[model samples]
Target: MPAKAGAVTMQQVAECAGVSMMTVSRVLNDDARVRESTRIKVMRAVAALGYRPNISARSLAGARSYLLGLLYANPSAAYISELLIGALKSCRAAGYHLVVESCDMEEAAIGEQMLALAKESRLDGLILPPPLCESAPLMAALEAARIPYVRIAPFTRLDAAPYVCIDDAAAARDITARLIALGHRRIGFIKGHPNQGASRLRLQGFQDAMQAAGLRSARRDICQGYFSYKSGLRCAEKLLNRADRPTAIFASNDDMAAAVYAVAHRHGLDIPQDLSVVGFDDTLIATTLWPPLTTVRQPIAAIAGAAVELLTTNRRAAAVLRQPAAPRRLLDYAIVERQSTAPPTTPD
Candidate 1:
């Protein structure tokens, strides 16, 4: 007899489908080796019986913790929130739990802290988001401990582990080129955090576009930012306060671009009329501003989800192959043009 809807177990589903419990498990885990006909039968039985696998029982049986860790040090709330949503959704789909840790420790202490956290949490794998993704000490500790990890937008050591990211340089270059095509010669650029690999790539793209246009970016036109609104404000002040202010400004992220908006308002400059502005990372802040920001959309949530998938997939492959190859994925990005950019009133 089939168990009650909420009480149906994997064993009951297997019996109902006339398949072994192992077949049911493989089907549930989305193992590619499962025959399509067998998979369909198992799924139909699962639906008919309302079977739900017991995660704890499955973990104990497989000698797996069924837990993943996400370590991050990024300061942007919008970015972090999107990342959490994606990771959590993927975890739920995979029947795994996520342990998120915020690393505020100094560089010297980060490795030790991560090592201790991994031991205490017994994480099956880890997901690293920028800045943290580029940490050598943390990577070294994880490698030494034989813990698997997936990185999102890592700056260096591309072959060290699996990773997922968009082409930051190409996206940055496209947006910068858009500003140039708008008849703006004197364009200001605000760089993202120096610690992030994307920052350097984005800056390089901006410079590349400027040079391609036969325009030279003055030293004063490029300001350093830490991917924070506060930093954006400071950079904006410096750029806008100058006697020869740029007709347009391109900030590396939406947060910084929003800061540019605030500073522009304070200086009594009308957007796209007095000064045009653009930003990257089409986070919520991009639309919340008065004149919606023209920015690059990097699919933050999708990237996070892909990172989780990569970690889970690699773990499964390693169990059988002992040494699965690390894969690097580059997702696509789009330039979302909104109300924030326009042709300069007077060509520079």
Candidate 2:
């Protein structure tokens, strides 16, 4: 229907439905006071007329912009893509429009930029994805503007906002333990960006698994990665170039794992033959890479959908907006075994 029926009006819809204009307004705002039968009738008329509400007029009438903001600065393109997919789907279903803004977390003026964006958009609510979700300044700015927001995968200040996430530490532990069970002792570890809370938790999970298996040593192989393709390339190069290179590598995310595959290929090392590799975030790179990737599946899209639901379904009371019920929703995670990993080949 032209993607949007911006030309249709509520007056036309009301006329078609044989209802009062006020009744149409009530149905549009989702007021429970409206009878369910009446709502259905109005919806039928709306569909028949291809009616679309004028968001600006609706705002002036009911003090609701009906626009939700999605702000993200995550390093993984695959992760961001997933977030967008889930959020956009939810927003459309809720009769709300989605506005996306990409901000650079590295920028010093993040708070000012975010505030400016909010002021410009007059958003009804916001959905924040990781790293951005933990930014104290940005959160404060949102509070100053009094905009309700939901966080996706925020680790710190769990009570500060409504959020959705899985047990990162446990997920990491499971994957690491799986590698240990595969008979790999000298497994390389590549960490994600320091800005993200999941990075630390995943690392701890890895360490905990190693300690439990008696694989911990005074010396170990680990590298820092920023969860970016470039950072993954850099970290993989450093880890692979070492003389006492690890028999296996576990990157914090799939992008880095893909990078390991590239680096191993350049060094003439065969997969699982010379080095076994694994990664987290079962993102697109997991299946696209050669031999695929054994990784942890984090439900990036479902988390995003949950965040949008929290933002839309909540009542507008000041207290309700300030403190959402069911503040933190923990979802499920799984270890997806692909072809990227195997037992370390017997030393020649």
Q: What is the C-alpha lDDT of each candidate?
A: 0.87, 0.84
Whole-model alpha-carbon lDDT for candidate 2: 0.84
Q: What is the lDDT of residue 210 in candidate 2?
A: 92
Query: Over the stretch 48-151, how does candidate 1's per-residue lDDT look in tens digits?
Result: 87676677877777756888999989989999999999999988766789999899736687888898999888888888899898888898888888888888
* Ten contiguous residues with the weakest lDDT in model 1: 315-324
- After superposition, the stretches of candidate 2 with alpha carbons farther than 4 Å from their true spots are 1-57, 217-220, 317-320, 324-326
TM-score of 1: 0.91
lDDT of 1: 0.87
> Tens digit of lDDT per residue, candidate 2, span 73-141?
887899999889988888876678899999999898898898888778888888888899889888888
